[model samples]
Target: MKAKPAKESLTIMNELVLPNDTNPLNNLMGGRLLHMMDIAAGIAAQKHSNRVVVTASVDNVSFKNPIGLGDVVTINAQVTRAFSTSMEVRMDVWGENIPNGTRFKSNEAYYTFVAVDQTGRPIPVPEVIAETEDEKKFYDGALRRRQLRLILAGKMKPDEATELKALFLSEE
Candidate 1:
């Protein structure tokens, strides 16, 4: 049997925020923002897995700032870690100011995706390589996330599991 390909190192997807993307308050709708993140995550997964992949879960998505109309939103994604069949993708959302030529972080999230074969069965994912310090940080965060998932799934007991969940929810 052929071995799986190595995980993707980096991915970035950007689009200009339009009026339709925002809500009545002129802020980007939460669901629309999540949709953008999902698209970015799916692209990153396909690039890494070289096959069809599906989003299994979004761990914690928090919107820190409201994206106003005309602001360009950029979603950056990277593979933090990988297991036998699942991979963790970290996505950061940034807003670019059209007038000031500045960019602000509007939100961030971590999503989990599973690589699947044509039959929709989970498959092994290749190892993720850390090529730089930032990559290392992302990997470390992914490690923590994996541990948290284990705790939630009853695979492990972490003393700070409750604290972790609280922190994650507070961001939202």
Candidate 2:
């Protein structure tokens, strides 16, 4: 299959953080934000793969800023890279308070998704082309990140992570 540009899988989702979605401190709950991110990332992965996709793993998600209640939450997701049957999606979340005209980055995360067939088996997905500088940076970093993930999951031996080894051993 022909490789698709990373932008082709870009997805943007917005949500209004209401009281129900907030915690006792009135900030948007972490779980709620994660749920939204997962949906947005899943959509991006599906767009890239052109097949049903399921969440395989979620990398560490760090909440940088608090999203207050009534704030507008915007999530931008894009497929950073595609492996044999899986894709890595990068998501950046922002919180906007329209009344005060303030906007801040709230969270960022990486999610892995596997394309699936009718029988729920993994299916091959199209590769991703990095056209822009930022895309190229993320695309190049994906392999190192994937190697670390596999190592942590016990799926790959540490010695076999050539990308990660190169990254750590390279003299800047």
Candidate 3:
């Protein structure tokens, strides 16, 4: 399969925090933000594979800042790696105060998506190539992340996580 650059799959989604999507305190709801992140990640995955995709898993989300109503929330996503049938999408969230024109980093998340056929069966996807320094760092870390995910899911043994093992365990 041909390799696609990470930049080609980059996607950004912006939303204005509104009363309907916020809590009584006027802060954006966590679930609503997660929904936006998922949509953005899905778009990045599809852009990379050009196939129907589904969210397989999402890593922990740490909400650092409370986004107030009227703040613009921006979610950025990019395909960091394309595994056999799954792609890892790295997402970042930013809260921008329009009046002050100031933006602050809120949180980051990693989403795994699987490309599927019309029958909803998983299918192979094109590999992702890292072109820039940041992309390369993400690409390099993807293997370890994938291994940890598989191990935690019981789909792979801890011994098979060579990338992760090498990072934490010292040689004799």
Q: What TM-score would candidate 1 get against the native?
A: 0.82
Order of candidate numbers by TM-score, starting with the best = 2, 3, 1
> Which residue ranges in model 2 land beyond 4 Å of their true spot?
170-172
- Model 3 C-alpha RMSD to native: 1.0
Per-candidate Cα lDDT values, in order, are 0.80, 0.97, 0.95
> Which scores higher on lDDT, 1 or 2?
2
The clash number for model 1 is: 0
Which candidate wins on TM-score? 2
Better of 1 and 3 by TM-score: 3
In candidate 3 the C-alpha lDDT for residue 39 amounts to: 97
Clashing pairs in 3: none
Error of 3 at 15 (Å): 0.5
Q: After superposition, how far is residue 56 of candidate 3 from its true place, in Å?
A: 0.4
User: Which regions of candidate 1 are displaced past 4 Å?
Assistant: 1-7, 153-172
Candidate 1 local lDDT, residue 115: 93
